[model samples]
Target: MSDVDSELMAGLARMLAAGQQRRAARAQTALETLRSYERRILREAAVMGYVLGYQSGNLDGRTGIGGPLDKNNRIPPDSEILRRVIEHCDSTDDLYPFLAAACDRRRRSITKARRWPGEAGAR
Candidate 1:
């Protein structure tokens, strides 16, 4: 895995460990704190991919394989971004929690995309 992926995973493991020790209101605060790191990491990872690809001359005009990104590669999928999207999710109570969990799952998916083989052992 790349150094960026390792760093992000390390940050997430620490956040999760910290969350385990939190209680009551503190747990909510901790989760929000984690959410911020989650956003930062996702942004960094996406930027890393886009920058690497652009520098490698892989992206061309408006309609090639990956296509032209203009000023930005597609924005990374962020947990908070998903949470905002979930604000419009079906309001059926059970579905609300499921959507929230889906946001977390997306964050995890980004790491999995990195294919960090040692992440489980390291974390």
Candidate 2:
């Protein structure tokens, strides 16, 4: 090919490669954002579970029963399984699994509630 054509082709190749890199970077950023959102949601859900559990226990005539917590940074919950789940984690990596456990209970509670809308202990 002519020198001009060769250079043009090379320039196009560079542009294509750069575009691909940009797309990959954008995808990575999107994935990271989604992951962050999921983690935050899980942590928040777990915290809600903890608060609800505490309230429920109080209402049900149980007094002074809850797991330890990290006050500075908000984390997820307490209970039969939730008590240990609340006391389980300290860091982000550790917290996710604990949060998941709490969320699992939340999930079960949801399913049970849906199945038996007017009953207690539906599951």
Candidate 3:
């Protein structure tokens, strides 16, 4: 091949490598963001469980049941709640709103359940 052809091939290879690197970096960033959201979701679910009087126990890897204990014997979040929340979230943008709405609904339900039957404005 002529000098011009060789140079063109070399430039094309560099461009391809650069594009691949950019894509890889973007993928890594997305993975990290998802992991962050996962942690947040678990924490929120745990809080919800605590509010609802779920007791902590030994770590058992079960969902919708008592969670296994950590080193301090504290149970993690309820896996079932986490699974449900994640099911409704299609992206990071949806996570915050979904989590907030879920928590609010839980709060309302708890409040409604606590009222006496004849209490004013009680459902």
TM-score each candidate. Answer: 0.26, 0.30, 0.31
Better of 1 and 3 by TM-score: 3
For model 3, the stretches where C-alpha displacement exceeds 4 angstroms are 36-123
* lDDT sort, best first: 3, 2, 1
Instruction: Report, for every candidate in turn, its global Cα lDDT versus the true structure.
Output: 0.46, 0.47, 0.48
Expressed as tens digits, the lDDT of each residue in 1-123 for candidate 3 is 999999999999999999666544443343344446555766576568654554433233343434433335354445444544443332342334433333333211335554434553754
- Per-residue alpha-carbon lDDT of model 2 for 1-123, expressed as tens digits? 999999999999999999666544433332343346654564566567767776676677655434233344333322223333333431232334333333333321234433433344554
**Number of the top-ranking candidate, with lDDT as the measure:** 3
Using TM-score as the measure, the top candidate is: 3
Model 2 CA deviation exceeding 4 Å by range: 36-123
For residues 1-123, write the lDDT of model 1, one tens digit per residue.
Answer: 999999999999999877544322332332454466654664465456555665556433344434454345443455434333333332332443333443344322344444344454653
* Candidate 2 accuracy as lDDT: 0.47
How many clashing residue pairs appear in each of the predictions shown? 0, 2, 5
